[model samples]
Target: MSTVAPRFRSHAEDILDALRENPDREALVHGHRRVTAGEFHDLVHRTAWAMQGQGIERGQTVTLLSGNLPEAIAVRYAAHLIGAQVNHLYTGLSADVQAAIVHDVETRALVVDPRLADRAAAIVEAVPVKSVLALGPSATADDLLALAATRTTDPFPGQAGPDDICAIRHTGGTTGHPKGICTTYRQVREQRKAGRAGAIETDAARQLVATTIAHAAGMLADGVLESGGTVVMLDDFDPADVLTTVERERITHLWLLPPLLYQLLDHPAMGHTDTSTLRQVLYGGCQSSPARIADAVRRLGPVLVQGYGQNEGGLISVLTPADHDPDDPERLRTAGRILDGVEVEIRDEDGSALPDGEHGEICVRSAMVMQGYWKQPELTASVLRNGWLRTGDIGFRDAEGYLTVVDRLKDMIVVVGGHVYTTELEDLLNSHPDVRQCAVFGVRDEDGMERVHAAVLLAPGATTDSDELRALVRAERGAMYVPARITFPDELPLTDVGKPDKKELRRRATTPTT
Candidate 1:
């Protein structure tokens, strides 16, 4: 393990240095707006001053609800410099989900765009949102930049330490709730070093951030910045646009999800674009079929690097470029050896370390493991028994020490590259007037992709088709959690303990679709 070094400076320090090192260097690109490192730094400071003027005190929670805009990045950095913890919500989220997150975080103000002003207004009334500020011409609370100019440029609320929580990242839970995972400034710094060190080849040059600025993808944005690399942002996932950006910006390093990779490999326009500049491609999030990985390797070159991690931790196990072999037997199967600065062990139910090639829960002890589940000490204790983060994932290590994840110990379902907690889906499905009893499980589709499937027992005299049931779910829950397949079971199988027999459902799903 690399001695956890003292690279302990707030993100603010990095941003400041970037401006000094290359003021004219392109720092961010969104749509028609291309900002230089120097200009971006000034905007961050001005935005911080503006936030302070709006009565957003240091340590206060400021919620950001916007799409991929340059202002969003500026606001986040400004808040960090002033000691305010940022809570970012995807603008694509449902109103109810947004409401839940805002309430859960107890944010005093929301920094949103004009397009989402209506959504923010509806949420602020029900929640404790004292004020709302829009990024564009929609002046509601205060103009972000104008407010900053009024204050002294003499850097108020100085530098932050590593232990200070930088952002509250939310992840879906098996308990039917989404909890915020606290990521500290120090942890973020270490995670960036780990990410770059794991990379077979990465230098302070050109980088591309194609993933949404919501979770791990967004975290990598900061990593690239800290490494003195220029970041080119994408508003959303589009293969054509991604290729253009890579070619136009001379992007060398990039991260992509499996679905996006599939599109990029299959996109007709990709052949015309100049992607020869790409040196490294970090891909992760969900399972990728061997065929997909092989296709990507053939089309995108051997620059593909796959990783396995959760929102709670950074890169856990990464299959670097060195591990990618066209002829190797284990090429497509392993998540790669345990990363440097991280320790891994497969343990049985009794917490005893299991032998090699034996399936068990994967436990990791590292600088990247989260402190604990926010405010849930009992649950935290269960997962953090000793100094390890007991990841609720079923996997085993081979003789070569390459870890392969088999299944989730918990019943969490990852469908189409996104996590869909079964409990959350069940709760939404059960809320329907027609649903008397329902159980959700993940089943494989014709394409061998995992899709959300549900077993529904309707109420007496209640009638509904698969489409109607799906529509009800869409209304009650987000689209991501809706069941793609509905089975009208006479009765759901039950365990001896009376819980829904999900294991039985999995068995039934494997039977011929007929």
Candidate 2:
């Protein structure tokens, strides 16, 4: 009788194949230890077997809360192998928010590191979590090995289809609490394809993940695994650790947000690190200032790529390496053209198509777009029309078919006679010599009209007066873009995912104006 191999139905299978093909190759580098592909696959299968031995059924949702440890990635894959939906939360989430997501997703099994076991217990109290498998300091290497010994090395029964839900990610909300954006196995698979469409795929490139692996970037890390690449993981951002890892691993591919890239370039040893192996650098959390991009290009060559998308919409547009020319006629203004399998449209209030160079809301439709909000049908209906997902961002498209994101629709500050985009003003301000980062908010002035209020954080040991900064912005943007009042701070608030907490900034801006 011919025994048919189990279908490669899950992403775990993809990892397993890669492991089997290169058992001796280093798959993950964390801390002082590195695990080969064969050894890693053994751990994954054994973990899946152990979970099955514990009566954890397939299709059950499991909440994962841990730092960017190699085991955390393994547990996620083990869940995938057993056909469980992995609910990943940011490790820095508050207890209340954690409980909310646990309850919202109905996650029964909790796989968390011992460092966060207390938080896991808090969540268990709020929701009836069936089982808790702890890893790290509280548990020993022997404990994990013992669990693997108890379960057979053979794979557990698989029970997932490509159409089944694979991952549940909670989107940061503006109104109340965050809502889960459930992604199907199909959607996640397509999003991975969209994220790596034009990029050269090579197993020789060592991927170093410096950002928190909780958001879309986390999924990108998993995509690296799917592509048969080695990953260097980090629990937190430390410039020295990043530089050391890059040099040690001869890292060839790096993906970072603009802020993190800025920190990396400013690191004391940045100039000394051997970065010749870096073949590609991708950044796309938000729009980066032109000056910052130029700095990165100068330091890391012209390999910088920018991708624009959100939790609701997956990869939408990409600024390829070819578009990194700082001296181009457009001068690094556009966000490059839309990627393959993406359709972008600029629509007016009535859903009518806007003319080129005229700003409007951006709407996108593709396989990469998310399914919908997990439970909020009303909200889902509002944002997703037919098959298109409406991104509440305002921007115009140039005649050459490049998209330029201006600002969020709700964040547009309407002044006395015209509308001003906070992001545009912030970008212009960030390009100034002394301004490291800035945010603009709408505050009421005389006559109850909304006026633009600016808050700035300066670079270390940098100095510039408000008058000079104002004059710089006025000269670059115009009088309308100048803030009515400007304030300086040592730093700005950041979200768990490391994006600027603009909501908090607006709250602070609305504070009595004292």
Candidate 3:
């Protein structure tokens, strides 16, 4: 960890100091407007004071529903200053799912972006939240900006301890209902410190944040601001907008999931845009196609950096820009070496450690790991055993210490005869030139036997026979690995966090057609 002076009380303090240091520097940019560091700090202070006035106390939860707006960042820092646990609702989730998370966290106050006021109102009705603050005009909630204007722009008197719960980030809910991961101020600080030591550039990083600030993009934005960098926020992701923003802002750092990266590559504007200023293009959240990643490196230069992490384990590993080499294709398959000061071990079902080259659960022990799941001791204990977070991902370490994630344990196809990993089949399907994207899973047949099934999205104006695709899989991995059914869908459903919605896919695959 980077040595910190005693004056820095918490992560919020560090940011406040950074903001003060560069008062005139651009802290956040959204559409046509930009907020300077000084202005942003004052906004955060007022927001914190307003929340305190609304009966929000330390340890209480403040749930926010917004995109990557300037107000969202302010509210997050405001919650941090007042020592309240902030829960960011995944905007893509259904109202019911978002309501469940609010109730699960026992949110004392709810904040909404004007665009999502209806969704927030639904959650407010479902949960017993005491207060509702909206970023803009709203019929059902108090206006946060209006309230901030009335409040003094002085720092909140209350300060959070290092061990205080800073944020309650929910899981992506790829498998089932999402669970809140308890993250502390100290954990976040340590992760930032470690990130700065490696991937985080020392020079001012002009970062383009096109994804939801509720997830990894938010974390990166925080780091950039703390290091005296600029955060360029986007309300929603558009391929053309991303390319244009990178060029317009001379964006040095950006983060995207593999799927979004593919879209940018396919977009006509991608080749025409000037992306020379981009120093790093961080990607994660799901497994990526090696062929697509290599293609990106060729087109966009060697700016691709793959980050492998979860809500529980902050950042386990990162495939650095130096590692993205066309000649060394095998390294691209790995999730990169274990992060500094993080211990990653592959363990069997019995909780015994497995040797290198053996596929098993990836367990992590690090300062960045979340404290535990919120208010779910049993569920927390199931994964957090002996201070090691048992990441449900099935992966193995190579002889060179690189981690290669095979598939999610629950998503593994279990046939009557043997098991089939979805990733293996997905990789094969993705290799086809005509295939834009694909998802593979196990579905029950008429005889109640689990069978391999696949849903694919073809490239624009491209066509391929399902039988030929199935035959390709059969020839590569034998009959057992071949999908029993292959359907060409316009597009596969995606989870709120942008991962392939395998749970939804299984439901669709098993549903009887008329």
TM-score winner: 3
For model 3 the local lDDT of residue 59 reads 89
Per-residue lDDT of 1-514 in model 2, one digit per residue for the tens? Answer: 8699756466667667777787888888888889888888888888888777777767788788888888878778888888888888887777888888888888767777777877877877777766766764443222343576667667555567877778888865543588888778878778777766756344566888787777755676676676678888877877788898899889988878777777788788999999989988888776677777877888889788887888788887877878887666254666778787888889999999888999899999998777888888998999898889999989888887788888888789988779999878877887887777777888776578988888887878877878888898789878888888888976666676667677787678777765
**Candidate 3 residue runs with Cα over 4 Å from true position:** 1-8, 200-202
Looking at model 1, which ten-residue stretch has the lowest summed lDDT? 492-501
Candidate 1 residues lying further than 4 Å off, grouped into runs, are 1-8, 156-159, 172-175, 200-202, 411-514
- TM-score, candidate number 2: 0.92
* lDDT (Cα, tens digit) per residue for candidate 1, span 1-514: 7988865568666756656577787777777777887777777777887787778876678899877677888788888887778888866555777888898877877998676788887777677687688886664555565566566555445456677777887763223466777777777767776776776344675767666676555666666665567777776667888888888988888877664675677668888888888888887775454545665677778788988887676778889777777556356667887788888889988889999999789898888777666667887788886678888888889998788876565666776657776645665565565765577788777788788889987766787778988887788766887787899987666432123567678789788775
CA RMSD of each candidate after superposition: 11.1, 3.1, 2.5
Query: Each model's C-alpha lDDT?
Result: 0.73, 0.78, 0.86
The most accurate candidate by lDDT is 3
Better-scoring candidate (lDDT), 1 or 2: 2
Instruction: Give each model a TM-score.
Output: 0.77, 0.92, 0.95
| RMSD (CA, angstroms), candidate 2 | 3.1
Where does the lowest 10-residue lDDT sum fall in candidate 2? 136-145
Q: Which of candidates 1 and 2 is the stronger one according to TM-score?
A: 2
What's the TM for model 3? 0.95
